[model samples]
Target chain A: MHIVICIKQVPDSAQIRVHPVTNTIMRQGVPTIINPYDLFALEEALRLRDAYGGEVTVLTMGPPMAEDALRKALGYGADRAVLLTDRYFAGSDTLATSFALSQAIAKVGETYGAPDIVFAGKQTIDGDTAQVGPGIAKRLDLLQLTYVAKIASIDLAAREIKVERRSEGGTQMLKSRLPCLITMLEGTNEIRRGSIEDALGAARSGVLKWSAADAGIEDLTRCGLRGSPTVVKRVFAPAARAEKAVQIDTAEKTLRDTADELMAAIFTRQPALEHELAFNSGA
Target chain B: MSTVNRETPRPAAGRAGIKKELPDHFKDYRHVWVFIELERGHVHSVSFELLGEGRKLADKLEVQLAGVVLGPPGEAIGNAIAEAFAYGADIVYIVEAPLLADYRNEPYTKAMTDLVATHKPEILLLGATTLGRDLAGSVATTLQTGLTADCTELDVDTDGSLAATRPTFGGSLLCTIYTLNYRPQMATVRPRVMPMPQRADKPVGRVIQHKLSITEDEIVTKVLGFLPDSQSATANLAYADVVVAGGLGLGAAENLQLVKNLARAIGAEYGCSRPLVQKGWVSADRQIGQTGKTIRPKLYIAAGISGAIQHRVGVEGADLIVAINADPNAPIFDFAHLGIVTDAIRFLPALTEAFTRRLSPHNRDKLAS
Candidate 1:
């Protein structure tokens, strides 16, 4: 059985700074890390490989520096890595991104085998859409099990998997057959550090790089920026409202006195609040 | 509570601003359609929310609001139609079949897209749930239409176009997208973001039974069976009237207990910032932010939260917001109703004491007796 883990290289949000003039993200010199969520996906896939005796392959589509992420995947016990990068792939949305990734996974199938399970993070911190997992599951015709809080069981022989799914009000235990895409929720598992031998093997291993044509995508028009429909016409910082709170100064007063003053001032500004408070003070 | 009549698609406007004058070809597109996402016999609430929102959009455009429900026949599909109208829909289109049961990308996608092709809608909206996101992506891809996910704002422009605004690039910035050239503008909004409409006493919507041309063999996937949640985590988050959510404040792992103590004292639920889960101090289910579960409790106490735009989008639904932080200039104060320029770790205990004194053992014992 072959397991595939899809990851992205995103700028560390803590290190990211916005360009005040252009109102655009300043990626310059900001270090990139494998999406924090994706690390869990990689570790989960490695755990499956260790238990099931299968090979794990890491896949990513990004700039050349993205290969660094794939190598890191190898250091984490993945058997192989593939990098799908091209100039034409720039400015791709989630839809276009899933297409490129699905094509790359298909190419992997030819070189290796059809993946028994494809894993991805719940979402990338950069996009925060969580759509790519479903998109890839759709394009590849794989069963999508999203928001999986735990992999309760996986029966490789039966090609079946059972997991707990998170929902608005409760968790749902969902069971589905294999050849599916499962997007693991974050904090479900801790990522393991690579062993010295694994790190050495990863440093020496070659990363497979593919252009659009190499990934078996026949229509260049349906790939990257062209395939994306929703165009971001513009992006700007949210304007801060030019208003201040009515400061209730009570430095020298007691809590009860301050509370009374607050109620008075609040009533002066919003008489309606007083009515609601009175009505709701006790039902 | 019968289904409403199936009306013809509303006629498209001709020679409008920009929009390329609505090509002589597309002047035929019309109808306000809600996608009733069916799971087992039950339906998701976002479906109702979309119906409520779709009703408003339909009224503004002066078109019939219809719900497109697909499920297995004799599996309570009609009940969903009544539920749709109870929430505020005027029409229902049902395509019932065995293949459509137990949401699979292939069957549900085929059923929905086929309905839209046979009967076109000017606008379509779905809930941004896991199933909704999965099914919407497939349906939109099959229909070759534009879909905006997690939209915070939805309205009609002067040109009668769906103006959709969503947080883009991790919610740091917002971008409004317009399906200027496309018909049946598609969008999905998360649950709890929109207010629930009052259910009508008598739902008088016309139900138009739809034709399911596809069959079981045509659809490849099977439900097999569903594993019910062994441990439910979602219910407590949604129904809690009072919630104490900690932001980056509360300092470290040990400090999160202060929030928990306050919550315990006030009989409220406790949650934390996204970074807390990232830090392994709390479970992801306890995180309260855009990426995490959204909460719309009546009273929300945000301690030490800096109120980043991403986190702000998640908690905007809280009715009464009280922000406590060491920094007076924190963004949380801008939107918070009650602002305190004090340390949360210290102020939290004090507020907890205040609330405890106000509604303590004596009051609780009296009420219980």
Candidate 2:
């Protein structure tokens, strides 16, 4: 079985800081890493390859710098890495990004072997839009299973795969055919550490770089800002609250005293909550 | 608010100056539609919340608000239709089929895209639940329309286009997005982002029944079975009246018990920050943050959490927020109503003991003092 896992490089959101005066993201010093959610997908794909004995290909659509993410995946035992990068693909939203990525995936199928499965993260930290995986599935006409918490079983002869999909209040055990797209939920598995030899091999490996044209994207308009239907009208910081929090004195007070004082302050502020708690405790 | 950036210009240069007329084909697209998500036998409350929001947008655009229900033919669907009307829908679209009994992408997508094609709705709103996201993504892609996910706010601009606002840059910034040229501008709102609309006794309105054209054999994905989460594990944190959340400052996984003990003493739900979930100490559903559950409890007690913007956005809506941390400069204090700069590990048990003593049946009267 051949599996293609799509990944993205995003700024480490935890390290990202907003400029207080300018109210813009301070992008200069923010380091980039593989989108955290995508790592779970990569690790899952690597595990499947290990068990089922198939090739795993890592795919990403971003600027040239995204090669680092591909190489990192390669270190994690991905057999091949493809970087779909082009200036034309800039400013693409989920719809356009999925269009480009789907085209690239189709190209991967033709160049490499046909893949039985396509994997993506449930969502990206930067965009946090979980639409691209399904968009790719629709464009490629593949079955889509999202928020998959576990791969329960795979019947290679039947070309069937079963997974436990995370739902609102429960888990749904779903079975789908091969050549399906899956967006993996986070914390499903811990990514493995690469062996020293594998890390060395990844460092020397040359990523297969593809432009939009190389990825079989014929329609340039649909490749970028021109194709994207959604337009960002404005981005700004949420207004700060008028007043800062009131500090409860804890320096000289004992822990019990502090707790009592805090409770008193809370009851004073929200008398209704105190009454509700009283009613609840009495019951 | 100072506008930091405009990420994308309108598609056409000249059309950008004026409110570009929607293609003549899409001009006929009218009304707003909310996909009423029916799972198991109960309708998700997020659907009703979206209807509440859709009501406002529908009224603003001078269009009818419609609730689209696609489920098996049963009391669930029937009750969902009635609830939609009582919530705010002026019209209800029904597509009942056994194929749609459990949400498979193929049939549900077919039903929704067919509904949009036949009776055009300019805007479509869905809850950002697992099922909704799965359906919305496929439907929007098939129709080649734009869809924004996890929107915190939705409104109609002066030109009558849907302006969907959501947190960006890890909740440090907010961006307003518009699907200018697409018909049925689509968006999904997280469960608790919008206020639940007041339900009223109203007669059901016009019902438009559509056909699900796909057969069971045509669908590739099948539901083998469903395992409902155990009652004790489910975190109904989004709608809880009182919430207590812990973060990495708790130091160890076992210390999460402090958070739960306090919560139990006060009859509140307990949760943790994203890191604890990432650390596998807590379940994903109990995470309180931008990528997790958004909550608006009456009283929120955050212990040991240095509030990042992501976590702040989720709980900032609480009526009263009390933050306890070892460091005085933790960001949680910035937005909290009351803050105690004390170590949560040491202070939690004392607070729990105090609440247990103050709120016990014999001492309940003391709370009033």
Candidate 3:
């Protein structure tokens, strides 16, 4: 089995902030991390490779700096990494992104082997669109499954796989054919720490770099801002509330006394809540 | 696949092109359409919520608002259409087929995409549920149009373009997107983000029936079974009156017990911030944030939550929000109605005990008398 996983490099959301005056993102000092959600997909791909005796290749599309994210995925036990970077790829929305990635995955198939499964994070923190995986699946004509909680089983001979797909309030047991695309849900598995040997091998392994032409993208108009239909008109910070939170002074009161006072304050503001709670509690 | 039109000239020189003209092929697109999502013989509330929003946009554009209903050939489809009329649809499009009985990507995508091609709509809205997201993504790709997911606000701008506002950059800022050059501007809004509209006693409006041309053998994927969550395990966070959530501020996973204790005592739903879900302390279903569930409880008690922008947007709709955290400088304090700077590990227990004692039968009976 050959498994391909798509990962992205995104700014650490914890340190991201919006400028109060200009309403623009403050990206000056923010460190980039392998979109935390992608780690789950990477870990799941590695686990499948370990169990099935195959190789896992990680893929990403970004600037030259994104090679760092690919190397990090290699350190987590991937066999190879491929980076698709080009000036024409800038400003590509989710639609253009899926086009570039599907083309690159085809290129990977020619050089290495055909991938049985294509994996990606459910969504990206920066884009938060969750549209690219499905777009890629549609372009590739693969069976697409998003929000997969668990892989129940895979029968390579029959070319079938079963998974528990997470839904609104329950799960759906779905069966599909191989060469499918999956967007793994977060927290499904913990990413393993690289061993000393693994880290040393990852440091020496070079990532295969590809440009738009190298990846078999013939249409320049379809690779960048020209291909993106959705345009961001304006970005701004949400208006601040005129009133700040009313602080409850815990300086001079015991914990018990503060709890009592807090309850009093709540009931004073919303009198209907007391009766509603009483009704629900059967008090 | 080239979108460049040789016949139509580009906008005149020098000025920035913020409002691009609609392409000639897409010029006739009119009405606002909402896909009414029905699964397991029941219509999801998010569909009605989108209709409510769709009504406002339709009125703004002075166009007809329609609900697109696709389901098995049965009374469930009829019932869903009737409910769509009650929720404020000027028209309802029905596509009945056994293939669409359960949502497989193949048939439903074909039905909706074909419907859009036949009768062009300027805007298409869908619920951000599992089925809706699955179907919307495929349909948008098939139509080669732009789609925005989990939008918080939707409106028609002065140029008559759909302005879809959603949080971006991990919810730190809000951006409004426009599909100016595409037909049928599409978007998905999650449950509880919009208020459920009041149902009026209105008859079903004009019905337009479409055909589904796919068969079972054509679909590559099949639904093997359905596993419904146990009644005890399901948390109704979206519609709960009161919610109690924990965050990473809780030192360890075991500390989540404090949050559950308070929730049980107050008859509230329990949840956690996004990081708690990522840390494996709680399931993804119980996560409250941009990527998880957006809740609008009447009262929200946030313990040990630092209230990042992602988590804040999810619970900000609550009427009364009280935040308890050890750090006084936590961002949660900025929007919470009541802020208490203290250790949640110690304060949660005290709050639970106080609510228990105050709401006991003995105290209620005495106060009533």
Candidate 4:
């Protein structure tokens, strides 16, 4: 079995800040980490390879610096890493990104072997669209299983798999054929630490880098900004409300007394809500 | 790589990229349609919310607003269509089939995509629920169109393009996106982001029936069973009347107990910010944020949360927001209606005790009556 995991390097969103005056991202000193969600997919792929006796390859598309994320995946026990980077791929939206990636995956299959499965994070924190995985599945015509919580079983010989897919209001136990694309749910499992041997091996095994042409993308119009259908017209912070919170001072009041004051304030503002809460408290 | 000529097909250079003329095949695409989502014989409220939003867009575009309903052939489908009309749909498109009863992607995608191919609509809206997100991604990909998910705002620009605004870069900022060249621009908005429209006593609209082209044998995936979430962990935080959520300010996972105690005392749902879930202080289901859940409670009590833009967007719809944190400068205080600067670890227990006293059996019985 060959499992290909797609990963991305994104600025740590927790530390990302928008300039208050300029309305631009303050990215000068922000650290870049492997998108936290992608780690979940990478770990799941590693576990599958461990059980099924197959190779795991980590793939990413970004600037040359994104190769660091691929190397990190290599240290996590993936057998190979591939980076698809080029000047033409900048300003790509989810649609163009998936087009570049699907073609690269096809190239990877030809150079190595066709993968039985492709794994992607549910979504990137930066993009937060959750479209690329399904987009890839559609372009490749593969069965797409998203928000997957667990892999129940796999019949390698029959090329079948079963999974618990998270759905609205319930969990769906779904069975599908192999060669499918999966977007894994976060926190399903903790990522493991790399061993000394694994780190050393990762240092020795450099990533397989590919430009757009190398990835078999010939349509320049379809490679980046030109192919992206969605365009960002403007970006700005949400306007701040004029009224700030009415501060409940705790300096003089006792803790319990403070709570009482807060409750009184709430009732003063929304007397109807107090009754509404009582009517539905049973819920 | 082939170098392409830009002049022959250039339409106009807009803000993000070059906008192109709508292909001759797509020039006649008209109307704005909202997919009325039905799950387990019930219509999801988000679908109605989208209809309300779609009405605005339809009016802006000077086109008819329609509802697309796909479900099993039953009274539930009829009821959904009726509600759609009451909620402001000018027309209704129905696709009835047993295969669409439970929403397998293969058949539903084919049905919706086929409908789009046959009757072209300029804009398609859906709820960003589990089913909608799953279905929208596949359908958009199949149609080779653009889809914006979890949009907070939708409008028609001067050029008649759909301008979908959503929080991006982890909710640090809002960006407006346009599907400049794609027909039937698709977008999904989370529940409660748009206000529910007033339901009028209107008759059913013109219903157009479509067909599903696939059968069960053709679908590679099958739903073996569905297990509803247990009552204890239901964590219906999205629509709760009162919500008490903890954050990293609690300091330790054990301190989450204080949050729960307060929630129980007030008969409120409890949740935490995304970091707490990542820290395993709480499960992902109980996490509150853009990625976890978008909640619109009547009252929200946020303890130890700093009110990142991501968390703010989720809780902004609360009728009243009360933020408790040690830092008075926390962003939560900016939007919260009330603020208390105190350690949540210590304040929570005291608040729980206060509520316990205020809601004694005698007072509770009086209030109940």
Candidate 5:
């Protein structure tokens, strides 16, 4: 019943702001968080570890400073933390990322047996790509159950897991084999605050840092930008629509008059809306 | 433009023109393709939406716009082709298969990538649906090409590069990417992001069918059964004409009722921010934010939502965006068409009563008379 949760350190979006003059992001002074979504995955993994007799290991790939994210994961009651960091891995896209993470998972397995379940957040708020978990599954050849809302049950003895997968409309009761990767959706569970002991242990505990060489990777090409097929040539803000919406003068008009005037204006533009309103009243 | 060639050399570059050896195969790939998503016996609107966008990229490169559709026997098959034509597709490639009855990954990816290999399309687009994201990755991996997920903007630069832009850092920053060396500039956009094209009256298009060489046993994953959503719960929030969305400022679950009341008064649908759903105040379906749902309503009443870029992207399409918040400095006012600096709790009820008086059936009849 061992669990592995993949987390990435990303710039805190709340503090992020676009420069008024340049319209580019002002990234200075913006601190990084453990990808807000990954918190949910880490929390779910911790809960699973608490319920079942197993250890939870947190994994992240970033610059050396990302060790802080791993330490924070350790602080949240995780048994161990692994940081897969290297300069070569800097420009890796999702494809390259999954490749590196998969190699790291294999490395971790060599040290501490293959995890029964792997956890990832539904999608990273930074990338919002939502493909890495599936990518890892494809690379590791693990059954992927994404956008999982809840873990209905897991029978380790039977080697079967039942989970509620979030679909287009509702939740689907998906049953998959063990050693599956589940991307936990937001709002499924609340992240638990670590106790004094947990924080103390994390403050002292060391995070195992592994680069491409240390991860038992035979091919360096598949581990970085060279292996990554996708490239981000440039980044620019979305162009605001040319025509802006006109704001009607409602300074003197009362709320009632405003609503009435708005309705009349809308009806003038869309004559069918008036008919639809007429129909809503069973006229 | 010469530098652009240096940047994106296609077909593994010329043998004499400095070809950086790629993995065995994937040396020659060209043209552009779009995946017209057909699910549950009907074509998703996003497919047409992608075609409208795909038409631009194809014209930019002076290439043909081909749609790859995988579906069962039905009018849906023709509808996809017809809709693709209306949306400006030059060719609609169909892969009729019983294995693709439901939106499963294995067979559809096989059909799409096979078509790409046989008749290579340099760029491929798919609607960012549950089905699309699932299928795109596998296909991209199999083809050994780069794939960008959840792109908000796609354009072909003067150098004939597919520049895909998407929000990064949680909609706080935008990053434009190029599938520089990869063939088939792959991208997926959520439904409603691209404007729907007008339906052409005639079938101004061509069709080329592909052989789907896949069997049920070949794919390990199986859709054992299908469960349809109930009518009451199936709320298509994306295209709702009148939308009332609440945010963290709503305070609590009980306050969300005010938003619902206002929505009811205006004959609108109600939803909330991701925070509200996180707080367990609403279902995930009702969450309206960057990662939740992108909506384009005629009128949008946002109460308590301090419109972050993440939320703004989802609601930017609203014709009339009226934001109500307690904080006058809330970002929602920056983009909102109309704004009122007032407490959402108090203002929501007042707006509800105001809409009620104006939109009441009795008042409508009286005004008509």
Candidate 6:
């Protein structure tokens, strides 16, 4: 079996902050990490490879610096890494992204091997759109299973795979044919640290690089901004409220006293809450 | 007015510019359509919320608002149509077949795309739930149109384009996206992000039924079974009247008990910020943020949460917000109605004791006074 996992390098969103005056994201000095969600997908792919005796290839589309993300996946026991980078791919939205990726995935099949399963994170934190995985599945004609909490079973001979998918109010046990795209949900499993041997092997292995042309993207317009149907008209910070939080004085007061004072302030601002809480608690 | 940031690269000028006029074929695309998500014989509340929002856009554009329902042929479909009209839909478009009973991407995508082809809609809205996201992505890709996901705001621009506003760059910034030339502009809003519209007793109007072209034998993916989450395990945080949530500042996994204790003391639902879910200290369902549940409780008590924009957007709709954090400059204080600077690990227990004493049956009468 051959499994391909898509990964992305994203800025650590937790560390991202907006400029107080400029009201713009301060991208400078912010560190980039492998998208936290993708790690779950990568780990799941590795586990599948280990169980089914297959090769796992990690793929990413980004700037040259994204090679680091591919290498990191390599260290995590993926057999090969592919980087699809091109100048034309900049400013691409989710639709254009899936187009480029689906084309690249087809090329990967020709060069590496036909993959039985493709893995991706449920969504990237930076975008949080959760569209590209389904988009790729639709473009490639692959069965898409998203928010997969667990792979219940996979029958390699029958090309059947069953997964526990997270839905709105319940878990759907879905069984689909192989050659499917699976987007793993976060917190399903913890990512394992790379062994020293694995790290050394990853550091030594050369990453395979492919441009849009090399990836067999026949339509140049569809690869980037030109093909992107959605245009971002403006980006701005959320407006701040007129009044800042009223500070409840805690200095020189006992913890209980401070708590009482805070509760009093809350009740004063929203008297209905106190009554409601009293009713609920008495019940 | 805000200046456009350099990091947000605009579409290039000239041939690829967004200023290009809508193609003549798409000029006839008229009404606004909201995909009424029906599963297991019930309509998700988010569908009604989208209708409420779509009604606004439709009113602005002076066009009709239609509800699109694709489900099994049964009384559920009839009930959904009636509810759609009550929730402000002027027209109802439905495709009923056993193939669409359970959401299989192939059949639903085919039905939705076929409907769009037959009756063009300029703007399409859907709830950003799991089912909606799965269907919207495939439908949009198949149609070769634009789709924005998890939009916090939906409006019609001056030029009649759908301006879908959503958090980008991990909720650090908000970007307004427009599908300039796409015939059926698509977007999905998360549940509880938009206010639910008032439902009135209105007779169903102009029902248009479409045929599902696919059969069960043609569908590859099969739903073997479904396991509903136990009532106790599910967090009803979105509709809770009072919510208490913790953050990374709780320090240890065991520290979460303090948060729950306080919530219990006040008979409130408990949750945590995204970091707690990421760290596996809490389940994803209990996460309160843009990427998680967008809650609109009456009273929200955030303990030790720094109130990142992601978390802020989720709870900002609360009637009153009270933030407790050790850092004096925490962003939660900016919007929290009341702020208390102290260690959450220590403060949480004290607050719980205070509430427990105040709300105990004997003291309840005194509190009521």
**Against the true structure, whose lDDT is highest?**
6
lDDT of 5: 0.76
lDDT of 3 at A256: 95
Per-residue C-alpha lDDT of model 2 across residues B204-224, encoded as one tens digit per residue? 889999988889888888899
CA displacement after TM-score superposition, residue B131 of candidate 6 (Å): 0.4
- Writing each residue's lDDT as its tens digit, candidate 5 over A194-282 gives 99899999999899999888987778787566677765555455555454333444568775665555456656655666555544534
Stretch of 10 with least lDDT, candidate 2 chain B: B1-10
Q: lDDT tens digits, residues A15-67, model 1? A: 55556566676667888789999988888898888887989989998888889
Count of backbone collisions within predicted model 6: 0
Q: What residue pairs are clashing in model 4?
A: none
Put down candidate 2 lDDT per residue, A115-177, tens digits, no spaces.
999999999887888999999999998889999999999999999999999987889999899
What local lDDT does model 1 show for residue B226? 57
Task: Give the TM-score ranking, best first.
Answer: 6, 4, 2, 3, 5, 1
Distance from true location, Cα of B94 in model 1, Å: 1.7
**Which stretches in model 5 have alpha-carbon errors above 4 Å?**
A28-31, A47-52, A152-159, A192-200, A221-227, A238-283, B1-28, B72-83, B201-206, B248-254, B278-280, B325-334, B341-343, B367-369
Candidate number of the best DockQ: 6
Clashing pairs in 5: A235-B176, B30-B122, B31-B121, B31-B122, B32-B121, B32-B122, B122-B184
lDDT string for model 1 (B62-154, tens) is: 998898888888747878877887888888889888777666666777778888887888888888887787777777766656677887778
Candidate 6 ranges with C-alpha deviation above 4 Å: B1-17, B366-369
Q: Cα miss at A220, model 4 (Å)?
A: 1.8
Q: Which model is ahead, 4 or 5, in terms of DockQ?
A: 4
Error of 3 at B112 (Å): 1.1
**Cα error of candidate 4 at position B99, Å:** 1.6
RMSD after CA superposition, every candidate = 6.7, 3.0, 4.1, 3.8, 5.2, 2.6
- Between 3 and 5, whose DockQ is larger? 3
What is residue B302's positional error in candidate 3, in angstroms?
A: 1.6
